[model samples]
Target: MNEIIRLQVALETDAEQIRNMMVEIERDETDRWYDNDERPFIPGYDSINMQKYHMWDKKYYKIMYDDILAGVLLISYTGREHARVDRFYIEPTFQNKGIGSKVITLIEGMYPMVRLWTLDTIQKSIRNHKFYEKNGYEKIGEDEDERYYCKTISEPIKEINRFNSDEDFSNQNFIQCNMQNVDIYDVNMRDSGFTNMNLESGIYQNSNLSNTRFTNVNMSNAVLGDSNMNKIEICHVSLADAYIHDTNLGFEEQKAPLIMERCELRSSRIVDSNLQDLSICNCNIEGMKIDGILVSDLINIYKSSLKTEINKM
Candidate 1:
């Protein structure tokens, strides 16, 4: 399981390092952020820019991932109901690992009273445009060299289709959409398609999962309790350290590697699964059986030999 990402307030001691990172970001965009027509001269990228924006309403947060610094976020609350994301930059090495989206989601959850959230990005950066759009932001307009995007938080719920009726969904594409908080219990999803979709906190109990596929899907903090998983497949999915309690992994043949660590199995059989590199430590074993032989009987035989050795001594 991965640790949750967080943002801490940037301290005064972090000023110089933050400025250095900002400078690096500016240099990464050499031809961008230049002046076309100067209404008023502004230092677009400067070391003392934070000091200039040091106010009660403005905030700077240091992005922390797994207890390590990974990025920075600067925002301002201009009014009681409005907020703006002034700037955000993640380390280049940590760009596309879902940290940016998670950080933005956390920020939005932090400010539930905020109605209108706005931001401006360089128009030349096509990737930036796609990112904001994927996060449900609408492109309102553009000015000089900046593209303005806004997301109204209190907008009406748009109607969305949530159920499928015995339809084949295999080999289809569904990207950057919300399927969160939807009921999928006892649904026929065999050979279905789910890619890059937010199915967070969705239920999948008593469903047909044979030949069902999942890639890059967010199943964070989900429950897979008391479900039959006979011949089910999963690849590259985030399970959020799920608890698969009181179940048996019975497979006639192994296809992929299975890893079981820090778990408890009582009165269960591990058949035909890949146990290569399997480790069992710090476990209480009594009346155990392996390969149709009583393990406890074997240990007792070995202990009897120890007693014989003691009699010889």
Candidate 2:
């Protein structure tokens, strides 16, 4: 009889089962990529480390088919807009039955607010690459040993974290949180409150910050690139020397005031914003518009020598 496949939070007791499965997975991977001279697996590869880190994320789950163990998954929260599918392997016995694809779909639903799902695998794992691509993920980057993949979510994020006072945040959780000078990449942070956090010198790359609050935060020297910042509210924030590129900052319904001073903007678009009383001086303005009126054309007409002749006529 076919058993129902489901995902449940894995308990510590399941470590042995997961480790045995990992051994098989490691053997398969090693066989696929390594020569006879190389070892089949890393030295000191312990099940304890796997179980420990999996529990650290608190999102590790056991993939069960009917009442039997099928596999394990370790998806961890990396940032506000991304989740990392650290490990996804089906038991060799359960392979080629469409269980992996179902697990992916389950994960997507589990975090509806996540804008991007990212993972990495051995560079030579062609089968893994194809599986991820078939499930809507695309290759983003790669290194000498691993290939990184990402899938973007188009759904609107409506999840909002409850508002809390700054006083309620403990110093251990806020001040000494050690959030500085760290790399936070590809994490889903929808509707989260970073309103009073001091994230100085942090690097937030390829992350989703939609509907996230960043009021009164000191993000000085932080790098925010290739991320989605849709509907984010940023007030009294110091973004000095911060590098922001290829990111979305405009919303369709809400009107937000964007103030730029002594900053360089190239190849970026601004729409549906309040630019009242805007002043421009000593800057190169080209190929621009406001309400379907080209500012460049208006400036040419007003500043041209022919303006006097037209006025007289």
Best by lDDT: 2
Off by over 4 Å in 1: 1-3, 31-44, 48-52, 55-58, 155-313
Per-model TM-score versus the true fold = 0.44, 0.50
After superposition of all CA atoms, the RMSD between model 1 and the true structure is: 21.2
Q: Model 1 over residues 1-313: C-alpha lDDT tens digits?
A: 2866899888777767767766766665553444554322213445554433432233778888897777888776544455778778886667778898898899988876566788888777788899999998899999877899998786533453334546766556765656544433224566776666666665443346677667776778654532556666564444444544334465447444455444445566655444566666676667568787877788799999999999999
Clashes of each: 0, 10
Tens-digit lDDT string for candidate 2 (1-313): 3557889988777777777777876776677678765633332234555564466436889899987888888786555566788678787788888899999988888877677788887777688889999999999899887889889887777863332323433222344365543434423556666656777656564477777677677777665643666555555544444433322335557645455555555445665444566677776677667667888888788788587878889
Regions of candidate 2 where Cα sits further than 4 Å from its true position? 39-45, 159-313
The positional error of residue 253 in candidate 2, measured at the CA in angstroms, is 54
Error of 1 at 135 (Å): 0.4
